[model samples]
Target: MSLKSSITGNTKVLCVIGHPIAHSMSPIMHNAVIQDLKLDFVYVAFDILPEHLEKAVEGFKALGIKGINVTIPHKIAIMKLLDEIDPLAEKIGAINTIKNENNHLIGKNTDALGAKVALLNAGFDIMEKNVLIIGAGGAARAIAFSLSKECKKIVILNRTEQKAFSLARDLKKIATIPIEGKKLNEQHLKQYLFHSDLLINTTSVGMAPNTNTILIPKEWLSSHLFVFDVIYNPLETKLIKDAKEIGCKTLGGLDMLVNQGALAFEWWTGEKPNKILMKNKIIEFLNLKQC
Candidate 1:
């Protein structure tokens, strides 16, 4: 809590709020942008449990907190607590970005936008690509809605058939793409992999201490396809490594984290974040920090 001056107090606050937030890299990512841009703002993390969300959001306004990013257990739950929900956030039924303006809490979904930017930043055009998103949780739903605009077709693959169908029903009204959801089984995955131009893993596979794990088999991947894993701990996921061995382009989750943080930084302060500096600092920080 470093407040420079009374005049700057209201403009200098931002944070990420969620329970078990020690796993978050938001501080390192956003702090780099804050310091590099020479802003009066600082981004911190608040470990707020589900029971405290309403109070926490109210505290944001009472204390004049500028904005925050919602993660994991709170993404969907925070929707009802907001004054207004952006169309993307409403359609996805989740919010990862929020702003406090005129004492009103406005929610937005930046994860999907971040994913879209990550795909294009890696040089794969999602516009006509057949996309397969693994995991039907909030992350899956957010990406499913955002990429729906760019992808020719989008499929949700979760372990449960019912959850998959539920997720599909929610997306039917938002995207023009042929959207569907199915239980991820051997047969289901085979058919899904065969037709997919892009395979995205939104689950916690290939993450820290689980670097050896992958959601899909290497042999099933296409040689000319794009394989993306939203896991950054191991830096190169098994899917990414295997895809690279087969000459398929790959993307890790770091870019999405940085891009989304950059956008959030811009939203909080009317300044462009130094992406290269932020990316390098994130990589450097994560590489050296203990898990």
Candidate 2:
């Protein structure tokens, strides 16, 4: 709230852009850190439709906005609009963070770094472990590509067999470990879940408004498995809750979200924001929404 008192014509602009931006907690979390650190920046959210992405990006360049975070429908599309793209982001086929440097926009993906940091902070080592990821979407691709070098094996399962196979093929080009893609079914789920050291859900099945639907059956989870769900809206998604009930270690997406935003914030400001403060602010905001 203190950020409002400091806004002026000279304040640098920062924002997250997505088609349906209302649900994003980035503004609350990022602004909290901005105010706490007393940075001359203001973080906001904008709902930019797919049709308006190009024009909106032009505005960012013209207005000298310090940086912007892309989400949802814009992450991949926005990459083509940037003046430059980070090599890692290019390989992942998506960019979530963009920096404006003298009118030149540079795009980067912080999602992988964020997820890795969150996993390590939670005390899970990726070294030589079998990782099972449910979903072959952009987030899954980032995670798989990021962990390919360390994990002993990576399995990607999706409802669409071809999509899963395609993702695996792409990952196999870079990953030294064995990477396989299979159709999501009881057989594959049971086989991988039984042997996997870590399980990550990158799909939106257990997100808010669809909180009742869980991709994995309760009986399939084992106490030895560690589950991480990339959904933070409900804080405790059904998958996370079930994993905990089964005595498996669990982590929600809130930490990953904060860490990614923190990486972007540091990239733009050249200063490290308080990650704990950022995460607490998001928790407080989400709790208020529940009320």
Winning candidate number (lDDT): 2
lDDT of 1 by residue, 107-176 (tens): 9888888878887988988778898888888778877887887778988899878888988888888777
Clashes of each: 0, 0
Global CA lDDT of candidate 1, please? 0.83
Q: Can you tell me which runs of candidate 1 are displaced by over 4 Å? A: 1-11
Each model's C-alpha lDDT?
A: 0.83, 0.92
Query: Model 2: runs farther than 4 Å from truth?
Result: none
Return the clash pairs for model 1, or none: none
